[model samples]
Target: MSNVILMIFTGLSVGAVYFLLGSGLALIFGLMRVLTFAHGAYLTACAYAGWFILRHSSLAAGPSIGTLLLALLVGVVVGGALAFLTERVLLRALYQRDHLDQLLVTAGLGFSLVALLNGIWGPDSRAVPTPPWFTRTTTDIFGAHIARGDFVLIGVAVLLLIALEAFLKHTRHGLVVRAGVENREMVRALGIDVRRSFTLIFTVGGAVAGLGGVLAALYANAVNTTIGDTYLLYAFIVLVVGGLGSLRGAAIAALAVGLLQQFANFYVNPGLGEILSFILMGAMLLLRPEGVGGKKIRLI
Candidate 1:
């Protein structure tokens, strides 16, 4: 029973990471209808940036809450800035183009960024230093041994999910963004600047991806060049299963995949967990092509 609980906790933690990454991808897809291949690079960049700050700055010699928060802040800011720049420079021209053009351009940018990362960080993986509070293996809470980081991740995920849903449903900016997502022409008709709306959405997506990168690095204790590509694939699957533009679906689907993957890894084999994820994705695609809450939209 304890083992089962442990797996569930671990799975939820992993799912939190996936949710953060997938939420950003889903947001971009929902609003911009752009399959943002460059998003992976954004994640990688934030991870590296945060890691570098933590390792090289005056905070390098010690682990403290200030260092942790500052590192995450650096990651989020850098990620948002990178995404904003990419949209303004590389992607603005292609917004009106076909999906093929968007894909090609973003994919090219992703590859370029990956190459750039190699040049700058080299091929070696980098580890993030967490605060002393997070390093403990377990904390005694009501007589149950639980991993400190796992439940923290889950709690963070839950809070983020609620905050996001509330923001989209309640706030004026959120309503405008949602309106833009449903109909840009109508939004423009209302005198809202659709381009600016898109910029805001893209920037938010980048921030979410950045947060996920920081969490993943902390959880795994390392970040590498290929992390973006690898997690991007997983994010795609999660988005497909959860439905595009649906945060609730993403949350549910993330937990499902995370649980399944963890269970398979424990009961079956390590590699088999990845295989199972794809198998689940394939089944979802076959049985419900539109995904859980996703509407059917033509992807050309």
Candidate 2:
């Protein structure tokens, strides 16, 4: 029973990160109709940025709370800036192009980002150690040992999810974004600045990805050039399983995936965990191509 509880907590933490990352991808796809292959690159870049800050800054060995906060902030700023630049310079040119063209452009951008990361960070595995407080702290509940880091991650995820829901449902900017998603031409016809809304959504999406990256780095205690690739497939799986353009779907899908993966890892081989996740996703796709909570989409 204690083991089950521990697994549940751990799964929730991981699920939260997946939710954020998958949500960003889904939002971009729904709003822009562009499949961004560069999203994984952005996530990798954020991870590296967090690793760099932790290695070189004075906060590397301080209280875990402060260090984690600082790293998350840095990740958000850097990721958001990168997204803004990419949209303005590259994505803007492909906005009116066909899906094939957009895919090719984004794929090229992703390759270029990989090359750039290699040049800067080299091909080495780097670890982001948990701070002193986190390393030493543990709580016993129902005869199970729970790390403080897990609690912190779950808390942050809950807060961010609520905030994102409120932003989309209650804010004017969010309404414009939703409008653009539904009918870009109609939004423009109504004298709204659709471009600005796109930019805002892109930035926000990037920030969310960055936050996920930071949490991943802290939890795994390692950052490498291929870290993005590791999570990219999983993020896409979550997006597909959750439904496109639906935050609620993404959240629910993430939790389901996380818990499923965690229990599979515990009862089965860890190496096969990803394979199992893929299998689950594939089954969902075959049975409900529209996703668990998405409207039916026609494929060309």
Candidate 3:
């Protein structure tokens, strides 16, 4: 019983990480109508940027909250700036072109950037520095030994989720974003320069990816070149199951997949969780193409 509880909590934290990655993908795909293959590169780069700050800066002597916050800030800024540039330069050229062309270009960018990261950072994982108070220590919870870090990740995810929901449902900018997702043509026809929204959307998406990258490193206790790649695939599955424009769906799908994978891996086999997740994605594609939320971002 304790084991089950532990797994659930662990799964929630894992799911929190997934949500961080997926939510960004969702927002980008939701508004831009472009599958952001370059997003993985954004994550990987920002993560490395943050890691470099922490591992090499003055704060490297010891764990400090300043180190943590600075790394996160750098990641977010770099991510957002990279995304803004990509949208203004690379993406704009392919706007009128075929989506396959867009995909190919972005995928190439993603691959090339990752390769650069490998060359620069080397193909190995580096331990992430945490605060002195921070450790992968386990605490008792209802007879379950839960990692303290799990609570941190889960709490952060939850807070971000609330902030996002409020932003989308209340803010004027967010309303434009939702409207753009629902009907880009209509939004444009209404005399709103949706192009501005496009850049904002991309920036927001990239910022989310950046935040996820930092948090992911902290969660895993390390940073690696391929860390974002592993999560990007799962995040795509999340988009498929949750729908392209639904944060609510992304959250639910993330948690479900996280829990399912953890439980299956523990009880059944080590890698079966990933296999099962893919299977679930296939099932969802065939049975509910509109997604679990029954929301479809019209392709037009």
Cand. 1 Cα-lDDT: 0.82
In the range 184-234, model 1's lDDT, one tens digit per residue, is 888899899878868887888888888888777878878889888888888
- By summed lDDT, the worst window of 10 consecutive residues in model 1 runs over 139-148
The Cα RMSD in angstroms, rounded to one decimal, for candidate 1 relative to the true structure is 1.9
For model 2, the superposed segments whose C-alpha errors exceed 4 Å read 58-64, 297-299
Q: lDDT of all the models against the reference?
A: 0.82, 0.80, 0.84
Clashes of each: 0, 0, 0
lDDT of 2 by residue, 1-300 (tens): 998998898888888878878888877886667678777888888998888777766443543566667888999997799888888888888787777776787778878987899998788888786676654548688888888778777787788778887988898888998888788899999999988888888888889888888778888888887877777778888888887777778788888888888888997878566787888788878898778767443323
Clash pairs (backbone) in predicted model 3: none
Error of 1 at 300 (Å): 3.1
* lDDT score at residue 286, model 2, on the 0-100 scale: 89
For candidate 2, the per-residue lDDT at 160 reads: 78
Better of 2 and 3 by lDDT: 3
